[model samples]
Target: MSFFNLFTQKSSSKISDKKLKEMLESSTPPLLIDVRTPEEYSRGHISKSKNIPVQNFEDSIKKMGLKLDSPIVVYCQSGMRASQASKILNKLGFEEIYNLGGIGNWSYGLKR
Candidate 1:
């Protein structure tokens, strides 16, 4: 692989839309988190995703009592906050963390 390719390789935490769709359709789906403001989430969000603003990420996550090995998928308005939340999850010892980038990337129907 080229040097640039090595540096630009996608992280394992990155999940494609197709893969995400499959996961959501499966019997056991990952926990989907929208790391945006409550107001933003209230306007529109991916169906079944829980609103957990990145600012209150840790506290909310801790309160949920999720197991460390639980699969979690995070997203934001434009991907940045999702990335931030992924890092926090990693630091908090979460084993399966997937970043679904931005909500804009989701092709499925959303809930308002």
Candidate 2:
């Protein structure tokens, strides 16, 4: 089965950045999603991460070109936006969704 297949199953695992980093280092790295506004995302984000911006998430998911089954790791400037985005993704039927809480907790650093 491919990574996309994972989304078909239900995921109950919620992870932290330290655990998320470990997965990135040892396992398949989930899709790191930044759910802040575009301006906030442009300011800085985890390296190689994609910006979806919570305000436009429902309409922009397809445009974001994210793999449906890919393990999703979402984050925001604080934690609120990402929390909202997480619920949205879940309703969209994405399995294996994980929220990284917020950018403030990212220690590996960010990029513009």
TM-score of each: 0.87, 0.78
Q: List runs of model 2 lying over 4 Å from the truth.
A: 1-13, 64-67
* Candidate 1: tens digits of C-alpha lDDT, residues 44-102: 99888999999999999999999978899999999999999998887777778999899
Candidate 2 local lDDT, 9-106, one digit each (tens): 55435577789888777657778788888898888888868888888888888666767677888888878888888888877777678887879888
Q: Model 2, 111: alpha-carbon shift in Å?
A: 1.3
RMSD of each: 6.3, 4.9
lDDT against the true structure, per candidate, is 0.88, 0.79
Quality of model 1 by C-alpha lDDT: 0.88
Whose lDDT is greatest here?
1
Worst 10 residues of 2 by lDDT: 5-14
